[model samples]
Target: MDTKLIIIETTTDDKEMANKLSHLLIKEKLAGCVQVNQINSYYEYDDKINNTVEYLIRIKTLSNYYEDVKEFLSKEHNFELPEFISYECKEVSKDYLDWIVKNLNK
Candidate 1:
């Protein structure tokens, strides 16, 4: 059977935090894999423009776990308002998709 999947995205200013989140998700079976990328971000907050280096975390997991993942991220995240966005996977490699489903514990 083809499994439904989603990619959840978030960002952190510290690599340690990124690693922590990544490991937590995998250890809890919330995500099959997490990819971290160093990125430069510029945005406005509190009436000022800000630029900073950040780590983008991409979490891949079954679509059914989206809400659980979102809740876990919000509670464990350090940011006052963490970015928790999800993109549904319309297409994925059959084998890779199977791997993701197999990894989920719930």
Candidate 2:
């Protein structure tokens, strides 16, 4: 069977925003765990190259809860087009995957 765990990645402009989103995800049981990191990002927007210091949020949760997570981010994120991406974890440890499933509401 395929692993049910997924890693959701997104960037936030500030630490406060990242923490707020993390708390929402955990409190709502949409994510089992969230890791926040400080990152320097470079990207192109409106034909201009931009560089920024941002927070990278890695959210771990069951794949089934992704839609709810996406909805919450869409409404709460500060960016016009937030970077929300999910990758199925093909080789997560059995115990970790179990933890994610157990923490999810559903």
Clashing pairs in 2: none
Deviation in Å, model 1, residue 14 alpha carbon: 1.1
C-alpha RMSD (angstroms) for model 2: 2.0
> Which regions of candidate 1 deviate over 4 angstroms?
none
- Candidate 1 versus the native: TM-score? 0.94
Per-candidate Cα lDDT values, in order, are 0.92, 0.88
- Candidate 2 off by > 4 Å: 1-3
Evaluate residue 106 in candidate 1 and report its C-alpha lDDT on the 0 to 100 scale. Answer: 48
Model 1 residue 66 distance off true place after TM-score fit, in angstroms: 0.6
Worst 10 residues of 1 by lDDT: 97-106
Model 2 residue 64 distance off true place after TM-score fit, in angstroms: 0.7
Q: Mind giving the per-residue lDDT tens digits that candidate 2 earns over 1-106?
A: 2248889999998899999999999998889999999999999989999999999999998777788899999999989899999998888888878777777744
